[model samples]
Target: MTDLTGLTIAEARDGLAKKEFTATELTTSYIKAIDSADELNAFITKTPEKALEMAAASDARLSKGEGGALEGIPLGIKDLYCTKGVGAYACSHILDGFKPEYESTVTQNLWDAGAVMLGKLNMDEFAMGSANETSYFGPVKNPWRAKGESVDRVPGGSSGGSAAAVAARLCAAATASDTGGSIRQPAAFTGTVGIKPTYGRCSRWGMVAFASSLDQAGPIARTVRDAAIMLKSMASVDAKDTTSVNLPVPDYEAALTGNIKGMKIGIPKEYRVDGMPEEVEANWQQGINWLKEAGAEIVEISLPMTKYALPAYYIVAPAEASSNLARYDGVKYGLRVNGDDIIDMYEKTRAAGFGSEVKRRILIGTYVLSAGYYDAYYLRAQKIRTLIKQDFDKAFETVDTILTPATPSAAFELNKVVTDPVEMYLNDIFTVTVNMAGLPGITVPAGQNDKGLPLGLQLIGKAFDEETLFRTAGVLEQAAGIMDAPAKWW
Candidate 1:
C-alpha cells in the first residue's frame, strides 16, 4: 500500500470510506512515524495504546457506515488542552502531574466527530513566549533547515510543536492556540496553514488560560482545505464558556469555491515597517499580484492605530494573564511546596514552579494591574484596543479582507532572540492586531525566503467571517502551489 502517513486528511477520509485501509492501519503508520521523529521534540507525551484503541473503534464505525465527518483521522492535541486521563501541562513545570477528569470542549468536539488523538504536542510554558525555547519541556526544533546548513531553527510559538508535527507528517494536523500570534507565526515558519478564528468562536473551558481575552484556539494543517475541515469540528458554542458566541458554525470546507471575482482586498500601508527583509516585502507584493490576477481589486488602506498594537497588546494580555494565573497557588491541584505557613507556601511554590518567561509576564501583568498604574497602563491599553478595533471596522467598510506578511522574517535559529525580550516580542508584529480587534486571521505558505526557508502571507477577515479567509486562502494556496515537506533529518 502507499504510505498512509503521507495522505492529507481529505484523502484519508475518502480512502477510509472506500475501505481502502482500516483506521488501525493508518493509526499504526503514524505511531511508527512519531517513534522515529523523536529528535524534533514535538510531543510531551505519547499515547500509542490509546490511539490504536480509538482507531479500532473508528474502523468499526466506518464498517457500519455510521462514521462522522472526521472519522478515522489521527490528530495531535496541544498540551494546553485538557484530555481526560491524559497529561495537560501546557509544557510548564508548574502543572506537573496534573490531569483533568474532563476533556477540553475543543478536543471533545473533535472526538465527537470521530477524530483520533495521537498525543499531546509541546508548546511554550503557559503559551507565554514568541519562540518555543521557554517551554520547560525544551524548545521544539523546526523541521525545515536553511539551505546547506544543519542548524536547527525554531518552529515559532507558543504553537511550535503543533506546526512542527504537521510539517513533519507526524500527524495529519494538530490543534493550536493563538494569543498574540502563536498559531499563525508558527504555521508561517513551518510551511503550514493555521487559522485564528474570531474571538469566542471556540470554547476555552478546558484549555489552560493565558491572557484570557486574547487566546483563541485553531488548527495547523498541511493544506488550507484540511484546516477548514478541522475548524468545522473544533468550533462550537459551550454552556461552560460564557464568552463563546452562539452563531452557527458554517461549512467552512464548502466556502473554498476558488472564485473571488470582484472582491476588494486591502493592503495596509502601516504594515510595511522599516527594516523589513526584502523577501518579505517581495512576497507581500507577490500575494497582491496573485490576488489581482484572480480578480481581486487591490486597494491600499491605512490603519493608523497599527503602530500602537504591539505595545497595547503587551499591556492588556499580561494584565489579564496576571489575574488568570493567580489561581495556580500552592493550595491548588498543580505543583506545591511546603513552607512555614500559607503565605510562605504560596511564595515558595510560585517561585519554584514558574519559569523565567512566565514569571516575567506575570510580573509585567501584576505591575500593569496594580493600584496606581491601572489607569496609566491597563485602562489606556483598553482604550487603544478599542481604537484598533475601530481601525479594522473602518477598513472593512471598503475592503472585504486585508492581506499582509505573516511574520517579520522566516524561522530563525533557536535561542537567537532569547536574550532580548523586545526582539522576541517583535515576532508577533504582524499578528497581534487581529487578536486585539477580535477578528479572524489565517496564514498560508506563499513562498520561500532566500535561505530556502518557507514564508507565509496572512489574510485577516471581519469578525466571525472565516468563510472569506478560506475562500481567498484557497486561491493563494493554488497560486503558490503545494509546499513540499521539509527534508527529514530527525
Candidate 2:
C-alpha cells in the first residue's frame, strides 16, 4: 500500500471510498507524521486521541456505505479558529489556556462534513506578521530549502504553519485565514495552493478577530482540487456571523476543468513592482505564456491605486486590530497579571501577553484611531481602500481575472527580514491589495527559482468567482507539472 501520509485529499477521498484504506489507518499515519515533524514547528497543538476517535466514527460510516463530503479526511486547523475544548490561542500568550465552548463556524462546517481534526497549526501572534517568525510559538520552517543551502527559510506568515504542514504532507489540507497576505504569501513560499475567497465568503464567527473587516478563512492544500474540496466544506452561511454572505456555495472541485480557453486574464501594470527578483518575473511570464498557450487572452490592465494599498492597509488593519483586541484585557479570560489597580492590571496583562510585533501594531492602531488623528489617518485610509476596490472593479470590467507574482521573492531565511519591520511587511506587497479590495485571490505553485525554492503566480478573480481561479490555476498547475515533495530532512 502507498504511504497514507503521502496522499492528497482528493486521492485519500477516492482511496477511502474504494475501501483500500480505513480512516483509522490514515489518521494514525498523519499522527505519526506530525509527532515526528515537531522540528518544523508547524503545529501548535496535537489531538491524536481525538483524531483516532473521529477516524473510528468515519470508518463505521464508510463501512455502512455512507459518508459526508470530507468523511475520513484529517486536516489541520489554524490556531485562529476556535475549536471547542481544544486550545485555540492565536499563537499569543494573551489567550493562554482559552478554549472556546463552541467551534468556529468554518471549522464546525468542516466537522459537519465529517473531516477529522489532526490538530491546531501555528500562526502569527494575532496574525500580525508577514514572516512566521512573529509567532509566539516560534517560527515555522519552510520544508523547501534553497539549492544546497543549509539555512532554514521561513514558510511565510500569518498562515505559515498551515502552508508548511500541507507542503510537508503532514495534513491533506489545513484551514487558514487571510487578513492581508496571510494565505497566499505562505502558500507561495511553501509550494502549496491557498485561496482567500472574497471577504464574507466564509463565516468569521469563531475566528479570533484580527482586523475584523479584513480577516477571512480559507484553505491551504497540496493541489488546487484539494483546496477546492476543502473550501466547499468550509464555506457556509451563518446566522452568528453577519458578515458571512448568504449565497449558495458552489461545487468548486467540479469547476476545475483544466481549461481556460477564451478566458480574459489581466496582468496589472502596477504588480510589476520595482526591484522584483528576476526569477519572480520570469516565473510570472512563464505563467502568462502557459495561460496564453491554453487559450486565455492576456490583457494589460492598470490599477494605479496599488502604490497606496500597503499604507492604507496598515492604517485600517491596525485600527480594527485596536478595537477588536481591546477585548483581551485582563477582565474576562486568558492570562492576567495582578497589578496595583485595575488600570495597572490591564496595562500589565497586555504588555505581558502580546509579543513585540503585536504591541507595535496595537500602538499604531491606537494612534491612527486617536481623537485627533482619526480624520487625518483612519478616515483617509478608508477612502483609499475604496479607491483600491474601485481599481479592481474597473479592471474586472475588461478582464475576467488578474494575474501577478504572488510574492516579490521566494521564501527567505527566517529572522533575516524581521529586524526591519518595513522590509518584513513588504513581503505582502503583491498580496495585500486583494484583501483591501475584498476580492478572491489564489496562489498556485508555478515554477522554482534558480535556488530551487518554489515560486507561485497569483490569480485575482471577480467576487464569488472562485471557479475561474480553479480553472485557470488548474491549467497552470498542469503546465508547471510541479508535484514533487521536499526532501525529508527534518
Candidate 3:
C-alpha cells in the first residue's frame, strides 16, 4: 500500500471505513513515521503500546460498523495537557517527572471520539518564548527550510512540536494551545493549519496554565478539514472549567462548503507594519486576490487599537502567568531543591527549576502585579485589552471576517531572535489580537516566500464563530493550492 502515514484525517477515516486497512495498520504506520522522524524532537514521550491496544479495539468496533468520528486516528498530544499517568511536564524543569492522575478534558474528548494517542509532543517551557527555544526538551526544528539552505530553522513556539509533527506526518494531527500565537504562529511556520477557537469554546480543565485568561486549546492539523474534525471533539462545556462556554459544539467540518460567495472580508490596514518583508506583503495580497476571485468582497478597515496589542499582551499575559505559575513551589508534586528553611527552599527551588525566559516573565509579571504598579501597568494593560476587543467588534459590524498576514516573516534560525527578547515577542504581533479579543482565528498556508519557506494568512471571525473561520479558511486553502510537503532530510 502507498504510505498511509501521508494520508490526511479525512482520507484515513474513509480508508478505514472502506476496510482498505485496519486501525492497527494505520497506528503502526504512524509509529514507524515517529521513529524515523525523531530528529525533529517532536514527541517527548511515545505511547506505542497504549496506541496499538486502542487501535485494536477500534478495529473491532469498525468491524461492527460502530466506529466514532475519529475512530483509529493516531494523534500527538502537546505535553502541556495532562494525560493521566503520562508525564505531563509543560516542557519546564519545575514540572519534571510530574504525571497527573486525570486526563485533560480536551484529550479525554479526543479519546472518546476514538483518536489514539501516539505520545506527548514537546513545547516551549511553560508555553513561553516565540521560537520554541525555551523548551527544556530542546527546540523543535521546522520541517520546511529556505531554498538551498541546510541550517535547521525553528518551528514556531509552544505548539512547535504539534506543527512540526503534523508537517512531518509523524501523527495525523496534534492538540495544541495558544497564548499569544502559540498555535497560529507555529502553524504558519510549518505550513500546516491551526485554529484557536474563541476563548471559552474549549474547556481548560487539566491543561497546564500559561496565562489563565489568554491560554486556549486548539488543534494543528495537516488540512483545514482535519482541524475542523479534531476541534469538534476537543471542544465542550465542562462543569469543572467555569470559563468554558456552555454552547453546543457545531459540526465544523460540515461548515466547509468551499462556497464563500459574497462574504465580506476585511483587510486590516494596521497589520501593514513598518519593516514588513515584501514577500510577506505579497503573500497577503495574493490571499486577498484569491478570496476576491472566490466572490469574497474585500473591505479595508482600521483597527486603531492594533498598536497597543503587543505591549498590553506582554503585561496582561505575564501578570496572569505569574499568578498561575505560583503553584509550582517546592511543596508540590514536582522537583524540589532543599534550602536552610521553607522560604529559602521556595526561593532556591524556583530559581533552580524555572528557565531564564520563565524567570524573566515571572519577574515582569510580579512587578506589574506589585502593589505600587498594579494600576499603572497591569490595570492599564487590561483596559487596552478591552479596547482591542472593541476594535474587532466594530469592524465585524461591517465585515463577515478579517484577514492579515500570519507572521511578519518566515521561520528564523534558532537563537536568532532569542538574543533580543523584543524581536522574539514580535512574532506574535499579528496573532495576539485574536486572543485578546476572545475571537476565533485561523492560519491557512497561503503561499511560499522567495526562499520557498511557507507563509500563511490569518482569518479572524466573531466570538464562538469558528464555523465561519473554518469555511473561509477552507476557501483560501483551495484558492492557494499550496499543499506541498517539505523535502525529507531527517
In model 2, the runs with Cα more than 4 Å from the true position are none
Question: Which candidate, 1 or 2, has the higher lDDT?
Answer: 1
lDDT of 3 by residue, 187-217 (tens): 9999999999999999999999999899999
Q: Which parts of model 1 are misplaced by more than 4 Å?
A: none
Instruction: In model 1, state the lDDT of residue 121.
Output: 97
Report clash pairs, candidate 2.
Answer: none
Candidate lDDT values, in order:
0.95, 0.93, 0.94
Ranking by lDDT: 1, 3, 2
Q: Candidate 2: worst 10 consecutive residues by lDDT?
A: 414-423
Cand. 3 Cα-lDDT: 0.94
TM-scores of the candidates are: 0.99, 0.99, 0.99
Pairwise lDDT winner, candidates 1 and 3: 1
Clashes of each: 0, 0, 0
